[model samples]
Target: MDTSTGPDTVIVGAGVAGLTAAWNLHKAGQAVTVVDPEPGMGASRAAAGMIAAVSEVMYQHTTMRTLMTTSAAMYPPLVAELTDLLGHDVGFRDTPTLDISAHPGDRDYFSALAEVQRAAGMTVERITTRQARSLEPALSPTISGAFLVSGDHQINPRRLVPSLIEALETSAAAGGPPFILLRRRAVEVLRAGEDATGAVTGVRLDDGTVITAGTTLLCPGVSLATVGGLPEADCVKLRPVHGDILRARLRPGRPPLLERTVRGMVDGRPVYLVPRTDGEIVIGATEREDSFDGVVLEGAYQLLRDAQVLVPGAADLELTEILARARPGTPDDLPYIGRLDGVDGLVISTGYSRHGILLAPLGGHLAAGLVLGTAPTEQDAGILAATDPRRTADPAVVDSASRDPSNGHRTPRERTAP
Candidate 1:
C-alpha cells in the first residue's frame, strides 16, 4: 500500500459536522484533508436545516438545550463570514418559527413542554391561532393553538454545504495550508502502535492508500462503527435512526406558501414546514429504526397530510423530492464529541441524530479546539463532559426512547422536529 504524509488533520466525513470542522481548522492554518466517497450527500443533504433552539427543547436534555442555543447564537456571524467570503447568500433565514397544534391533545402536550421551555429560560410565546394566521395567512384557521419562537431560525443545508466546500477551495487556492478532498471511503484507521494505547496516525482508504496526519477527526455519522481500528467503537454505541424528508415547490407566481417555518403536532405526530428564500418548501420528517433504508410510503403520506393541516396551500405545491437517510443516534441523544479514552491524536464528533445541522457550528468549534489544544471555556467544558464518548456506553443504561425525552409516549419511531 502506498503511504503519504503531510496533512495536519484528516476528517473522515464531508457532512456538515466534518466540513465545518475542516473549515475551522483550515482557517486556523492547519493543513486539512477531507475524506468521503461523496461529499455533502449524507445526512447533511437530507436535513431540513432548522436551527431551532427554543422550539427543539425536550423534557430532560438540558445539555442539548445549552448546546443548541449556543450554536443558534453562532449562526449569524458564521453565515455573514461565509457570505463575505463567497460573495453570495448561503440560504440562512432569520425568519421565526411558528409552533402549532392540530388537536387538543397536541396543544396540551406543547403547553406542558412550553412550561419546561420557560423554566429553562427559553423564549416561547403563546399566540392565538388567529394571530398565527395573521403572521402567515396560509395557516389553517382550525389549528388548536400556536406559539412563536422568534429566536429559532433556519439555514438551507443544501446551500450551506456547497458554500463551505467553496470556501475551503478558495482557501486552498490562496496558498495557505493545502485543502485536499479524497473521494474514497476510509476502511481502516491507521495507528502508531498495535495496542489500544497507541495514537492514531491517519487512515487507510479502500483504494489501498494510507494518508497519515498528526490528528484524525472521525465525523462519519452513522458509519462510524464500520470503520476499523478504534478501541472505543463499542463504547460510542451509535445506532442508525432513519428519517424521511420531502421537498416541494410553490407553483409559478403562487406567492410564497409561508414566510417562516411552521412546526405542528398533528394527531400526536410531529411535522414541520421550512420555507426557503427561493420558492421551495421543505416538509418532513419521520424517525424510524426499521431495516428498510428507503422512504416509507406511510411516512411520506403522514408528512403531506399533516403539512396540509398546517397550511392548506401545501396541497397545491408540487412535490419535488423525497429522501431518507439515517442519522447517528447515541444512547442518551447527546452527541459524542471528544478524544477517545486511550487513543491519542484522535477525536470523534458524531451521533448528532436529528440535530446535525443545528449542532454543526458547535461541534466543529469543539472538535477544532480539541485538535489545536485550545482550552474550552467553562461552559464549553461542561458541554464537553456531557458529550464524552464513554459516558453512556453501558448497555444497562441504554434506552432507545432516550432520543425523545419530551414525551415518553412517543414510539421509537417518533421524534420532535426541530
Candidate 2:
C-alpha cells in the first residue's frame, strides 16, 4: 500500500479531539485527513458532552479549569457553526446545572464551594435543597445543599459526532476541503530514525497500508497505549480511567431529568447526569483507573444506583443502554497535550482524562494554530508549553509489556500489579 502523497495533516483517532482538529483545520483552509478504525464507535460516541467548567473544577486542576472555562465560552458559536452546517440541532442546550450534595453533613462544604466559585466571578447561585429538588424534581428530597451554575450546558455527543462527520464529508465532497476519514487503526508511527528525534512521516495501519502524511495528530483516546513509537514509560504511565455511563429514554411528561447538565458529589466522589434535548437522560460514570476498554462495568450500574440515590426518579426510568468508556487519565489528571519533544510533525492530543468532550474544540483550535505558526492567545501558549512531550525525560522509550489491550476497565488484579 503506497501512501506517498500525503494530505496537509493526518489525524489519528476519530474521537472528538481528532474530529475537532480536522474541522478547525479545514475551516482554516488546511487540508486534513482523519484515520481511526472505530471512527464514531470510540470514546467520542460515549461522551456525555457536559460543558461544566466552574462547577466541575477540582481544587488542583487550575490549568484545566482555565482551559475548560475558556473553551466553554466558545460553545455557542461553535455549536451554531456545526448545527448550521448539518442543518439540524445537535441537542446543545444551556440549561443551568445543579451541583447537589447528597449528604446532609456536606452542606457546609458545598456552601463553601459555591461561595468560592461566586467570588471567582463564576455564575453560580447557592440554592437550598428544596430549590434543587424544584429544579430537578427527579432529584431526591434527601439533597441537603446545591449550587446552580447558569453557564454550565450540555450537548448530546452521540448526535454531535454524526453531525460532525456529515459536515466533514460535505466539505470534502464540495471540493473546498481536504478532510478525509479513513476507517483504520494506526499501529505505529512511520519514522526514519531509531531515536525520537526522527521525524514521523506518517503511520502504518493495523492492515498493510502505510499512510504518509505531512503531520499526524494523536487523538486515539484510550487507545494511545496501542500506538508504537511513543515512549514506553509514557504508555505504562498512561492510565485508562473507566466511566460507566447509562442512557435512559425520557417518559412522556416526565419533565426534564436535568434543567442543565447536573453533577453531584456523593461520598466525596463526583458524578454527572446530563439531559439531552432528544429526551435522553445520560447518567454516568464511575472513575476507576483500569484497563477495561470497550466494555461495560458494574460500576456503570452503580452510577445509576448512586444516581437514583441522589435523584429518586432515576429508579423509575427505563435504562436504554450502558456504556463503559475509558478516559485517558494521568497521575495528575491533566492531559498531556502538545508537540512531542523529539518527533517532528507528530503532536500528542490524547490524555484528556474525563474532560475530553469539553476540551475538544479548543484543543483542536490551539493545536492547529500551533502547527500553522499562527499567533495563539496567552492561555493557549501556556497550555502548549505545559503539555509538551519534551517535558518528559525520555521521548523514544517503548514498553511492549506495559501495553494491556485487555478490557481497559480498571481491575482489582491490575490495580495491585503496578
Candidate 3:
C-alpha cells in the first residue's frame, strides 16, 4: 500500500473535535480524511453548548477555568469563519448567564463562587432577585438571588454540528479542500515499521482498508479505550462521565423561559436552562461519573424538579427528548491535546469531559497545529503543557504514556550510565 499517496492526515473520530481539526487542517492545504461511524455525532450531540468559562468554575479547577476562558475567546472568530464559509447561521448566542439560587444558603454559596470568579478577573455583577426577574420574567418568583456573568455564552451544538458537517462537505466539493469522510471505525493505529515502539503510520479501518497518513490523531472521545495499537494502560486514564439531558418545548404565546442561559443551584445541585432561538429549551444534564446507566426516571425527575425550582414553568412545558451519553473524561479534568512524549506522528485529543463543546475550538486548532509541526501560541502552550499527554505520573519520574523508552521518547532510562 502506498501510504504517502493516501490522505496526509487520518483523524479517527468524526465528532465536533475531529471535524473542526479536519476543517482547520484542510484549510491549511492538508489532505485530511476523517474516519467515524456517523459524522457530527458523539457526546457533543446532547451538549447544550455552554461556553461557561466563568460560571462552570470549581474550587479545584481555577487553572482550567482560565484556559476555558481562553477557549471561549476563540468561538466568535471560528464560528464567524464557519458561518461565512457555509453561509449558515451556526446559532452562536453571545449572551450573559444568570447564576441564581433558590434558597438563602445556595445564595451564600453562589456569592462565594462569584467572588472566586471575580478574583479570576471574570466579569460578574450581583443582581437583586427583582432585577433578575426584570431581565427575564420567566423566574419562579421564589428566586432569592442572582449573579450575571456577561461573558459566558452559548451556541446550538445541534446547529453547529450540522453546519460543520455541511461546511466540510461543501468545502470538499468546492475543489480546493481535500476533506474526505470515511464511514468506518478505526480498529488500530498502524505503526510505520517492524519496531514495536515505532512511530504511528496510520490507522487500519474496520473494513480492512489501510489509509496511511503523515499523522494520526485519536479524537474518538469516549471510545478511546476500544482502539488498538495504542498503549491504553499507559495513556491518561479516560473514563465515561455519563450525562442525562432533557429537551422541552416552550408553549406558543408564552414568554421565553430563559432570555439568557440560567444556571442555578437547586437543593445544592446545579441545573441549567438554555433556551434555543427555535423556542425549545434544553434542560440538562445529571452527571454520573463512570456510570453509563441509561436515563433513570429519578434523574429525569430531578432535572424537572430542579429546573422548576428556578422557573416553575417547566411543569407545563412539553417534553421533547431525553438524552443520555457518556462524555469522555480524565481524573484531573484536563484534556490531552499534544504529542505523546516521543511517539511520532500521533496525538491524543480527547478526555474533554463536559467541556468538549467549550474546548472544541482550542483542542481542534492546537491538535491541527501540532500535526503540522507548528507550535501553539505562547498562552495556549502554557495551558497545553498542563494538559500535556507526556505529563509525569505521580512520583514515577516518567510519563505514563512514555513508559516505553524505545518509542523515540526519553524516559527514565538515563538515570544510569550507558
Each candidate: what lDDT? 0.88, 0.72, 0.80
Which candidate comes out best when scored by lDDT?
1
* Lowest lDDT 10-residue stretch of candidate 1: 406-415
lDDT of 2 by residue, 1-418 (tens): 6555478888888888888888888888788878888777776777888888777654334566677888898778889998887788876888878887778645656676666566667877887778777777778877777888888888777877778888888877888667778888888888867654478888888776787877888888777878887663263246677867788877877766666666876765566778777678888766665576655556776687678778787777778998777777754445667775556787778778778888878888877776666887787878776565444444332222123222122224323110
lDDT of 1 by residue, 354-405 (tens): 8999999999999999999998999899899888887766665455335445
> Best-fitting candidate, measured by TM-score?
1
* Better structure of 1 and 3 per lDDT: 1
Candidate 3, clashing residue pairs?
Answer: none
Residue 345 local lDDT, model 2: 80
**Which candidate model has the greater TM-score, 1 or 3?**
1
- Candidate 3 clashes: the total is 0
User: What lDDT does candidate 1 reach at residue 123?
Assistant: 87
